[model samples]
Target: MKKYALNLIFVFMTTAAILLNAYSCFAKDIAFQSSVDKNRVSLGDDIILSLTFTGTQSIPAPDFTNVEGFHAKYIGPSTMVSIINGSMSASITHKYVLIPLKAGKFQVGPVTFKYGSDTYASNILTVEVVEGPVSDNRPIRTAGVPPLKFEDKIFVVMEPQRTQAYLNETIPLKIKLYVNKLPVRDIQLPQFAHDGFSTEALDRPRQYEEIRQGILYDVLEFDTVIFGTRPGISNLGPAELDCVLLEKQRRTGGIFGDDDPFDDFFGKYTAYPLHLKSNQVSMTILPLPEEGKPQNFSGAVGSFDFNLEADPKYVKAGDPVTVKMIVRGDGNLNTVTTPNIGSQDNFKVYDPQFKQEGNTKTFEQVVIPKIETVTEIPAVSFNFFDPAKKQYVTITKGPIPIKVEKSTEREGLKIVEADAISRPLVKKETLGRDIIYIKELPGNLRKKDAYLYKNKLFLLLQSILLLCFIIIVTLNKRRERLKTDIRYARRIRAPKEARNGLKESKKYLSQGKIQNFYDTIFGTLQKYLGDKFHLPSAGITANIIDEVLKNKNIDERVLDELRSIFNECDVARYAPTEVSVEKMQNTFLKLERIIDYLERQKL
Candidate 1:
């Protein structure tokens, strides 16, 4: 009986020791920590802000009122329990999706939370809100559909052709939209506010596809010219682009909830407004040199060719003559002026008429010789600073020679004769009759009753002729399409080829010949890309395809589909794996979709 009592005592002590150890573990110091998925993020991007409580499982939600510059929402709480070395510990993490409102550096938390008898404040986290989304490199995983990633999908970038330039020099700026798999619409043109530079109006947006970091993206490029007005550090911009994205919507609270298997198959899409912005770009504008400056420089800053010419080299003293001076080259032609022709006292010079055609400017001046003694028009010189040569160049043309003759038509003609020493004079007499003048008008004006165009019958005939002309032109274009245009013929036949290829692929798929099916699909794609881009089949590589279609402005979704089909084909052909019928069917459907899309495209 004593031994039994001792065993009971030992059992009670063991139980008490276990309970105390558990209690000590629970009573340990509560550790509060806060973190973010990324330290820097764009204004429209989402940052996962988390507050974790360790050493306890009964944690109340953290109060995140201290988070600044962002709108935070409590997503939910996740609890994790683990047993390490026979000790049980737990951690509760509260996640908040933080959407930044403005761009700047901000702080999140020092969030305070309560668990049992202890109060804990999380560590502070610093985040930077930039102008665009942070780049995410993780591969996307999807069950049925191709994986789509936010970072690879759609974004905007601002780039300059050159970062350093001289004052008043032209700089090419390109703002582009990069899209991978997103359906975008209602795209408003990008805009930016530049303080120290003058920008030209953006030209039409150009569409193309580019491969960046092994991912192909459809790029919409908008080009503009900017010139720095003053010397110093000049800013380009924080460009902003606005568009709408058609994204899949998550369905909730119905027979078909998120967990429903049919959700991925029959998903509904909603239009979400997306605003993208690019970071500001800086440029250094160096001041033009002050040395070797010309006195007659007219602020011209590019290469130019100068010439001078005069028409009607021989002219009466009082008659008008035209002298033209032309300067042509690539530069700011608007700022160019005619060179000064010194000393106008020998002639009467009218105000010069200036006309600019493209990169050439002509100055036409009307000059009348005031005296017969004047021999030539004075030489004209043009001086300008050539930035390329880094020197002042003075271009001088010839002093055009002119023969000035006395005007005989100013007054009646006069005849004079002179004899020296002794002279014999003979007198002659002649009789002349006065010429008779006509009394009638030179030409008869025969009047008609009505104009041919004013007649109703004539107008009806003309309309009929115009209708016939339109019909004939239309028929001629159709005939030309059938006979002369090879590209048109190819385009017309492309759909038929695609259908035949699809039929062959379907046959192979039914027979369970995976290699043959993928090879056929691959060949079809190569042919399609080649046909659409007018490229050779042998040269149809992924990079070559991207290059060929870069200027075609194909849609991002179509490009993504093409890339996925290619990748699937490559894997099925080279890798030794069991290709499922469902995957082959998906690939076939994707191919059909791509073919249909390309057929509808204007390329």
Candidate 2:
């Protein structure tokens, strides 16, 4: 009896211990977060505000009554439910998204929330409102120019041939580096953004003798072509140049065991500082037209000529005819519409295979001969408008002739079914069968309901569609919220974008295409700038970037690092001296480090 009692007690204790362990492992039921635009806010200027929370239990919303010198605007609230690591968890964020109506030296009182009978309050936050510039309390230095480098005054200008173009239109964007008072050494083309367009270099940079704005300038030009994707507006920014400026500076240095304190602070020292800066250029984007467009219109842009032909115009009815179409011109040949082959009663048509060649400026294609058989092949025509001539041109083919021939004789085999009248059912006789035998009645035949609701598969499909519709609606709403909250969206994707350029550069190097390798690098960096500052690359210049960075509260050290990396790439690529493979490889590796460091840092 005592042993049985002891066993029962042990089992009960084990159960209790297991329950306690499970309860202890449970995640905290509440989370807290707070954010504001400026620690030292300015009066009359709006400061953004936000709040975040996570919990499993239902919690009452907090009150925002009688908050001093602060007004709150309730943009909205959203909840995100997710299963993380085999555990059900949820987060409900209540955003104030406030724009302060008035500001002063004030304290925002602790926010109180009720969870069951317990109350929780956030810590009070103090803010100072000032009228003058929000002092960042950082030293300001002149944009430094690196010594022994031609980059201090050197810069790049990207002039796109056309900002507005059709889907397959050839865009010849020219990048010109205009040498100012500084001597001409070399210039290189930066990388580009690849989304929504296909790109190819027009030609190697060419040197030209030219004068601009009453001054003789040594100019080098590079060109490229871009094919827009769809009928929608987009922006292409200018290719940025990072030039190293060689500037001389005097500074004080320290020595080991120096007795003089003044020598330690301002010991005379001469050193050259490398000044770096990233410059951006912007271009306008225009969407292609879709309305009144032809069904078979290929994505061809620019001017072109069309020709149709068929080998062996005369053939037997059973023999196939090969109809070929050749489109050649300066415009987009790859995207040309399929030629219309006139329909005939006795003829059957098949789709033609297509092939294309050439870069952006000049594209060429040939549609393989479409095979078909006919009693008589009729005339075919193709029509298109000529922009340069300002008139319509229509090309036509002849009404080809075909001959019919009787079939060759076969010895023994015979076709079973020819025509309904040609075949009659063969009758068979069964002997010794007196009484007619009836098969047992088949199972009951029931008519199925045709109504949509009665179809199980249809109902399931409808439910899936409905769920998709709900998801789309939710996504649209979230997009609107993100648009309104620009800062949040930028924080998520900016780092990845910056790192993408350097990573792509490595790939190009592995492929052993030096020019393309550099191009990818520049393109990636330009994309980062656009995403970083919310400005199109076309409109950004070194001066513009410097100004924006100043406004962004970025430190001089970070800016210097950015400038140095860009300068190294530009000078190395375009310098009059040839860039060795070893030097290029080294620079490529350095660029990776620069990008990684920039991404890990906060601006």
Candidate 3:
């Protein structure tokens, strides 16, 4: 107990010293800077303007009551603190959403903040607003949303690059989630109706600010490529997303004033599940034109460049020569097959190996000349429909010159003979030694298990054998049951699965993908619980803390920690900046503790 107390005191002092060092670095310099997430935005799009103050988190918010050419709304401030290798840095960023109202170039202010005795100023930023829609800027305003303020605080929008496209043509799709200065968390990926189109998993969503209807909003955009399988006018996507919306009850103040930059960090908000959906879009997918269609067109719809390469123009009979075919450009390469080649009768052709890297598809084929008379490799032809040209394109290559020489070597077997060496032998006495003589007197004889002590020893040996048999039988039964009972097997393997998930989380954290890292952590917890208790993972929720674990012999402290972890995960899903690295590490430790506890308990 004394040693444990001393260890705890040492940890406390160490943590305090580290934090003191980290924040002391923050006391040295105060840098005030301004930057915009985008230099240009569409008339209805939102621009994110950030005023960052380094070396301090006590700065007051900038007043933007009247900003020209754009409607400004203050979103919350984000604070970041870090200490690596005893090198400390800290900053607090005050971000605002600015919506452009007209088309023109305008210079925004060198925003000034008056905090206590110090007056801080930021750099001026120039922005340009454009008419119609924005192509260069990644942010876009929802096309059909009404200009007036609506009841919904959050919503989603879907946009397809083209309304009419050829079958198998790649379609770039973008889906955006817009939050109008609202506290939201636990945002899930959007699901949409896609009956005739095939799509890949959505790319990682990117966050930015946008303004719709004089209100500034935070936007998350998800992008993916889709291909149309059937040709016809099809309605795609009334897209939907599930998120937890937070409603602020009131401001919870800190040591600083009411407009404290740390309010968001310590603010309390209640969360409620919200669902959002977008409008449906009608798209016409046309089949390739039949007039100029090639006989070999295999549903490849895009402009492509094809190349055929053959190695070893000169080779001996029965020697293999390689043929490499590469098809590269825009479009769906998964639908493209290997191009056709001639001279199959003259050569022995093996199965071709294929690989795809981005837009390029490759085929490596080996062909051996059966006879020496074969002079050239056959010509290769590839057919694809060029949507831009509105015609079928056939790329023809090869018919190169080659030389085949007759094999000069002959096959035969030669006999090998072994040489023996002769040696002189010694006398027969040296090869064989003399025999042994028997002892005359015999030792005392004893019968087993005759006396009291001997009987006890024999019984002990039998008891040991019986215990070993029982252990072996128990282990064998467990092994057979594991093969048949999936629930029991999962329960046994829960700890290992949780450890693997934590490993993946650490890797993502190192890569600076905080959202993915937290996602793995949350998923790890859910999967761990499901596997440990034999519950379906999809149905696991925070309510289960009482419903599922109330009677399980879990300690009150562990249950409280589990509840805290679930709450933090809910908040960290969308608001990752509010969650610091230290907090995440603590969360990891807590998760390990919970898993360890559950690992020792049997359900």
Models 1 onward score TM values of: 0.44, 0.33, 0.50
Q: What is the C-alpha lDDT of each candidate?
A: 0.73, 0.53, 0.76
> In candidate 3, which residue ranges exceed 4 Å CA deviation?
1-49, 52-124, 127-152, 211-215, 251-266, 413-603
Which is better, 1 or 2, measured by lDDT? 1
User: Considering TM-score, where higher is better, how would the candidates rank from best to worst?
Assistant: 3, 1, 2
Clashes of 3: 2
Q: In candidate 3, how many Å is residue 509 off?
A: 46
Model 2 deviation from the true structure expressed as Cα RMSD, one decimal place? 28.0
Candidate 2 residues 141-211, lDDT tens each? 11131232344235566777666665556677776666543422112345555466777755765544344
- Tens digits of per-residue lDDT, candidate 3, 236-265, equal 998998877767654645445577543454
TM-score of 1: 0.44
lDDT winner, 1 or 3:
3
Q: lDDT ranking from best to worst?
A: 3, 1, 2
